[model samples]
Target: MTPIKDTHPSASSAVESGAPGARVGNFRWVICGLLFFATMINYMDRQIIGVLKPQLSHELGWTDTGYANIVSAFQLAYACGYLFGGRLMDRFGVRRGLSWAAFLWSVAAVAHGLVRTVLGFSIARLGLGLAEGGNFPAAIKTVTEWFPLKERALATGVFNSASNIGAIVCPLTVPLLAAKFGWPAAFYITGALGLGWIVAWALLYDSPETHPRLSVAERAYIEEGRVVTTEAAAPWLSLLRFRAAWAYMIAGLLAGPVWWFYLFWLPDFLQKRYHLTLQQTGVRVGIVYTMAIVGSIGGGWLAAKLIGRGWSLNAARKTSLLVCAVCVTPVFFAASVENSWVTVALVGLAAAAHQGWSANLYTFVSDTMPKRAVSSVVGLGGFVSGIASMGNAQVVGYVVTKTGSYALIFAWASTMYLLSLLAIQILVPKLVDARENERRVVTDDGTSV
Candidate 1:
């Protein structure tokens, strides 16, 4: 049997000296790379349908409402996935939990090719949504586990940027795949990529405790800033008492639908408004997602940089979010902009801001919440966000179908970040680590917990 090493070590010991010249190994980054590709493949599968929406709708005779319902199917399940996925990761461990979710979602993605009706598509999306729910919870939890406090955001930015890459990949490839093969082939091929990823994930991923390739210096680096925790993970009900958790959840509820709207509806908007061909739309969409990649990584970097410069964790995270929020305001005018490139520029800027906002937002959770509860908290936020997304889809479909305008939705997206930030300010006024409070509470209660 493989040895199960202890998760905690003394933060004071090993204190950086490593045989005068021993270097920290990059194996942790290899672990990060695995996460990167897993996330990439995950988004690729998720966005394929959106990329192929125009063609699918035409071929399958889908009205906007029907399509909205399909999207909602995915959103509803995805929301629930966020809830259950987090808890499962906490219970069973992220390594097994994330892989299992990825495998099942891949199978569901493949099933898309077999379906010909709206109801069938909805069912398949439901399955995919539920399975894909594990991705963020697992990724966030793993990052918290593997990285020290300062490096967490940068590592998260790297993986979260993969979402944009996957989004970019879909727009660039899915349409072409449909043109060359068939629509079903797009789903089949994208889904298969995840199946392949599982092999690599299973072979490579282990907790930092037992990873054979980790160097002592690197392991020491990880432990140096991580909060020492051997206590059992707090229950979900218990975690709800914290204001910080609610702040995170509100951020999700406000901003999540906007991202989903961009992901699911942007292509159709291009088709409807610009009258672009499939190829043209894909190229344009790819460009927008590329901008998002910058936001995702840059957002994470900005906060980390501020923290390095002696900013409080709260100040750094919130400051980065403020910048992103201001950047998103330009997108409100995108709908009314007469020039196509101008519209693209505006939308691209906002999309970038959202990704940046997300990278920081995720790091914020790991920064403030105990590592053990990080996944569950994010899962809860995602669940709330998913619920909002489900409603947003319906609203979008009705508005677009009835009014033939997405002006209202884009306008709302522009202001949501500011509101979310306000909520965060009200709830998490300081950025103290929750673990410190946990230790105090345990001591006060005279309990081992």
Candidate 2:
């Protein structure tokens, strides 16, 4: 990977360029909004099962091991899908890739309503996982295409916060939906919502240069100083040779499980630990995810703010990550806390910090890689994360069964971010863009080759 300097026009330059008739339309933000909604729907579909875990467990007579297996099946399929989905997006572009992914996942989400046995649910979840794996890769790639380096993190955070939004929306609505229409309707409603997003996405999304609605000034602003690569997008396998890829993959491996633990186990934890009903658990889970939304946006903004103050990208991003890591340490004490609300506060802080860490980590791909390769690299990382999450699912299920306690799981969650940070530091010592140093040879006539 080559290190590239950003030559894009500065914010002041963009403002100056938008003179007279050159209106700098803020259409990029409109695209960001679309990505946000897609992600919110993506997560809501996945989170519904977790929110309804107690009801599902009781209804199906599932043991801890059985539930873990269902989750593990999804993770296994998600791992495979992440590898392929990222590459598919790179080859096919976001418009087609995301549309297909959303449609398939939506179908799978609805299929869950028809399943009765654990095996049947596992099959449905596997399908959901396979399709949902494409979401982040496509979203991250879209951000890289539409936003300049300075704004990519904030764009990523803005869209990424949608995951928490989806999580929040799940609890807020799923319980009520299940109560009113039965559990199957919860799946049907969330599943059907994606169909609408799919139609809107197909109608609205396109590359900035190709978008008819984009103004010339806005397109130029987006393209200015971006490294123009003529080489074909790097193969997914080639990304592994770069240390930056390893940094991202390792960080994902360590941190992905923590999020999975929260997503899959948190509601069950509330029910078993505090004896909360479904409605109460939903409210509490919504609160935790709401905090995560704050962290996701705040984390991204903090790094951008630091960059504006002349901090190195490395310093700015890593500093934000370190602060997030420290915030998570308090969660270790959560398992020991006596008051349920205190436990919620501690876990909430940790969840928020994880989102903050994730925002920076996702930005690292866009900051370091060529736009053409961003999706592939992100896919590689997600593939690793999916595998790790699969293992964690099994471990969590087994440990909880044997010990009948969440203490060990909470202890492990608190340490992952710091270790992930260390791996990132070792692998990517400087947050440098890989294409920075490449020189495009020109003929004597000043014509590019």
- Model 2 alpha-carbon drift over 4 Å, by segment: 1-23, 437-449
lDDT of each: 0.87, 0.87
> How does candidate 2 fare on TM-score?
0.94
Ten residues in sequence with the least summed lDDT for candidate 1: 1-10
Model 2 agreement with the true structure over 180-241: per-residue lDDT tens digits:
89999999988899999988998899988689987767876787677665534565555665
* Per-residue C-alpha lDDT of model 1 across residues 1-449, encoded as one tens digit per residue: 11124454433354344443246567878888988998999899889989988998899899999999999999999999999999899778988998899899999999999999999999999999999999999999999888888888889999999999999989998887898998999889978899999999898899987788776667776876455666356577667767888999999999889999999999999888999999999998999999999999999899889999999887888999999999999899888987777888899999999999998898888877777778889999999999999999999999998889989999999999999999999998887685464443232234434
Clashing residue pairs in candidate 1, if any? none
Residue pairs with colliding backbones in model 2 are: 2-434, 2-435, 3-434, 3-436, 3-437, 4-436, 7-225, 8-225
